[model samples]
Target: MPHRIAAIQKLTATEPHPERVAMFAIAGDSASGKTTLTKGLVEAIGTHRISSFCTDDYHRYDRKERKNLPFTPLNPECNYLEIMEQHLQLLILGQPILKPKYHHADGTLGRPELFIPSEIVIVEGLFPLWSKLSRATFDVTAYLDPPETVRRAWKIARDTTKRGYTTEQVLSDLEQREPESEKYIRPQRAHADLVISFAPVEGRSSLSATILLRPTVPQPDLHDILTPATRDAAHIKLIRDQDGKPVDALHIHGHAPEAASRLVEEKLWEKIGLGGDIPASLGRISSTERSAPLAIAQLIILHHMIHC
Candidate 1:
């Protein structure tokens, strides 16, 4: 796939202080591991350098109200989108806002409270990059694009276990969410500076990842140097997936070797010029670029701060 260059590379300031509370957005569809990846990034960056958050806290209505909506999860109409954008702007400007809480397990909204500011705040959830008003607040934005099959399976498992949904119920909800996903969620892809995906090979648990940099950046072909052993262990393989289309027909899943993903990550750090191995709390992946979705987010904010 051919790469796209960002039309506007202007970096917007997120905080008054360059050293603290820069804003980032990780946008993706349901079950794309946005939360898991964000958590890993927070751990990798260390709690001291980065603070963590989920835009899931910004829901206007609790799960019950959401379930009753005509359009389900992807429905922009159902969420307090305007409110979310408003509060995000408030928080990004280094001001405090009354944050709401939603408890998925109970399908309820918890009490609201004021959250003090932090150095780096990660906003991860569906539609984190939904509107121009909200998208502008982000210095870096990444879109997650794991294969549909893997996403569906992950959704089924997650909803069933964590959210008290049966497989049948999950399917029904997914179907309802599909239309809005195409209309609202998918288009957000164009707004992202980077797009990354993780999928399994034909017969394995090895998760392959692909990262696409907006042509505006100086990122190189990161797939070349991935070693054979790395691919074998992580089960990651990279096929050119430029412009949302596959370049070659390669089997994904456990079929991919771990080296494929590692090679890309190795190239990631070498390019970023940011050093130091990944911290232990961030899972077994030791490379910084493997955490591209989040790290790129930081770069976005940093660029704006330096330039602003």
Candidate 2:
């Protein structure tokens, strides 16, 4: 009996622990499509297996309070970075935390709530990858790099419609935050494993997506999926990164034929080995509108979430 008990303990020790969790960080400047991308991922992966929140909730000041401060919220000084780091560490260990909340609509801080970590955790916002300590908590990280014009337009639309900001106020705030954005926000892109950009394809209202895959982490092998026959829908090529390093850039044409894009999506879904139809929510831009490029991007990220 004693020998059998010892053998059981040894076997259990080698088995995968149920409490192991994977954390992902999606960091970008304001209105750079961070939340939208995160939303699609959460939906695709199922919220039961995912817990997501915005790091913006750690803001040290409300909008009214920031009026007296020299720096905008984009500055690290305006957020509770230390506390955020602590919470991230806790979540990585499958622990729960009482997280603070900041309401964007009224620019007010709300009561803290208990947040339990799931199998996967996605933290998105301005400073998820701000420091080495914070970046170390995530298994994977992605940064949104939409063009300035596109991001500006998105900010104006979202702020005016949802955040109670006028176009003039939004524009002025963007101008004021530019310096901080340049200093604090853009620099985080260098630390991300994937850099994603969505821009308008000429003559097409939809936006094309370009994803730069860095070798910091292992990415899916797309050679078999993106072939000459499907080149119009998506393709990959070697490109020089900002630091002059060679990286693989995957481009998904927003204007490609639906069938062609769907074939690529199907192949990617097969690689995930989830064994079901793709989630109806994969590329949703709105309740009624969907973008193929957005869907493809989300699938690629989903693959990393499960396999990384």
TM-score top scorer: 2
**Which residue segments of model 2 deviate by more than 4 Å?**
1-18
In the range 1-308, model 2's lDDT, one tens digit per residue, is 99999999898777565497899999999999988888988888888998799999999999999999999999999999999999999888777899999999999999999999999999999999999999999999999999999999999999999999999999999999999999999999999999999999888888999999999999999989998778889999899999999999999999999999999999999999999899988899889999899899999999999998
Estimated TM-score for each candidate:
0.72, 0.94
lDDT of each: 0.63, 0.94
Backbone clashes per model, in order? 20, 0
lDDT of 1: 0.63
Stretches of candidate 1 above 4 Å error?
A: 1-20, 216-276, 283-308
